[model samples]
Target chain A: MRLDLFAMALAVGLATWAFRYGPTRLNLSNMAPDSLLNRFLNATGPAAIATLFVASVLPYLEQAGGHEIPLALGTLAVLGGFAWRRSVVIATLCGAVVFGLASALV
Target chain B: MSAPADAPVTATPQPMGFRDGLTAALPIIVGYFPIAFSFGVSATRAGLTGGEAVMLSVVIYAGAAQFLALALVTSGAPLLVSAVTLIAMNLRHLLYGPALLRRAGKEASTRQAWAWAFGLTDEVFGAALGALARGKRFSEPMMFGLGLGAYAAWVSGTAVGALAGGGALAAYPALDAGLGFMLPALFLALLLSVLSRVQIPTIAVAAVATIAGTVWIDGTAGILCGMVAGALTGVLRRPHAS
Candidate 1:
């Protein structure tokens, strides 16, 4: 077990080092154009948002079943909290609380 | 050797230094610590030793897929199936690669690009992009510093949690179940922050489509279906000037 842990730790360090140094050795930055990179940059944010929506929200909605009440209530609480306080943490807490309470009550 | 001239600008100005990047990445590092701690706990519950759990995080470096693969493997799933599933789940990284390559390419060498690509995660990508959007050219060393900080937290967290035993994690049913919700909640929050009124309908439609598709397909495949749908929706929408 000790050997395995040591090996894993070594590998992690090596991987970090390689990732840190490898790009300097290869010089890829010059190969890609700034314009193309810009296009890619613009695309990534929406893509990431889409990916997150697909991966997380879609799954939650599916699990929520036919009754949209819990989801609706949760969304309202989250949005309302965010609107009132403009706080991500508060919005999340509101959603979680509403969801948990609705789950227990219903 | 110098900071890139054309890095994307952020709303708030950030100082271009290793110290600043470290400071910016601190929240994410702290956030990852406990989650990685849970992962370590879960890995040990599946009969892996501290070393094995740490190795999984180091090699895989993917959170959800790693946990899922570990669970599937310990549950007697065939090695091939587990391996394939893990690959499929992580295929999203392929998209992330090009995006990061473009942004970091200005200042980073080919070797550095490869390193950043390999080291990239949801948090790293978000933080780096957020930095870039602010017109900050993160020196390679700074990026490396941020990545390394998060990496250390993850591995150390796993090691510590594994050493602490899995029994305590199991005892807290709420925390255990809530673990699944954290990623989703974080993603939702991020999505909300990014979307404007114009994009809301597209997001809603894509999300609904994805939920509908998941009924027929299960597991990671459903996620792919939803992503495809969402991407299509995004493409169809008229481009907005940023």
Candidate 2:
């Protein structure tokens, strides 16, 4: 019964709903593909994902201490698995397995 | 399914209906379960109650943003800052509906847009776009079915995972550590799925900016800097040239 966490959830929910539902109402179907807004929106997905990926991995890299090899191999397994199967689930599972096995060996 | 030989011709294929949409959502449901479970595990690990974890899934429903929210909350970040950062991280969602509608073209009906649009997650958007590209007619019932299926899977998966409790994986030290890699791996996989020559620069710039910001300021500041810097670079780049 943490009121604060519930409150945060509701607030984040409302804002996310607005982002999801608002644009459909605006009817921006005619927006030029090259418009700044369009381009920014287009680029935002990859850029944000890239940002999150780096932000998440950096801390782990910083604290690798003795886990660097496992970490590196796990990342490579993810890349290799995705390149081969083109499935996020498979790739992530592969990476986790590599990470786990490497951790045991290391 | 192929059309009957005697079916009348039309510019668009017949609507696939709610059942088909649910069927189409099978892959998404499979994909979402593990991630949603991870989120639930992470949420409880971050000190949120099981109800709170499920509530976050039931409400916010954005996978990556939920992970980010958990991080921010655990760090004792200001509430407003957490909310704003989550919103910024999800801003790409604003483009999904318009992009889908534009692809669906003038004949598509958005009269029920307000209701169906609420389910336009990245994967949902990708699924819908893929459906349209396959020449299927758009229908609100189908969108409803797809969204409902994914939403149910997410919320239910979270509940189950939360019940597994925060330390459910603690006994498996390797697995627990590996779970930490899941988010980064997931994000990277997603980015690669949509990678393009045109997008390389934006990604590189964003990655560099995020690293710099993280080194000098903090993770949150780095995310903001990366997003703004990468987007601006994208705006400046010519469409045909990288």
- Model 1 chain B weakest 10-residue run by lDDT: B177-186
Per-prediction RMSD in angstroms?
8.0, 2.7
Please, what are the lDDT tens digits per residue for candidate 2 over residues A11-47? 8887778888888778666778787887887788788
TM-score per candidate, chains pooled: 0.59, 0.89
Candidate 2, which segments miss by more than 4 Å at Cα? A85-90, B1-12, B236-242
Q: How close to the true structure is residue B24 of candidate 1, measured as C-alpha lDDT?
A: 68
> For model 1, how does the per-residue alpha-carbon lDDT over B122-238 read when each residue is reduced to its tens digit?
677777777777677656666676777777887888888789777764655545534434444444554565566655555665566555655676544454454555555545555
Residue A68 deviation, candidate 2, in Å? 2.5
- Model 1 residue-pair collision total: 21
Error of 2 at B226 (Å): 2.4
Model 1 ranges with Cα > 4 A deviation:
A1-106, B1-17, B46-48, B70-85, B88-111, B186-242
Q: B86-197 in candidate 2: lDDT tens per residue?
A: 8777887887887888788777777877777767787788788888888887888888888888888889989987999889998988877777677887777778776888
For all candidates, state DockQ relative to the true structure.
0.16, 0.62
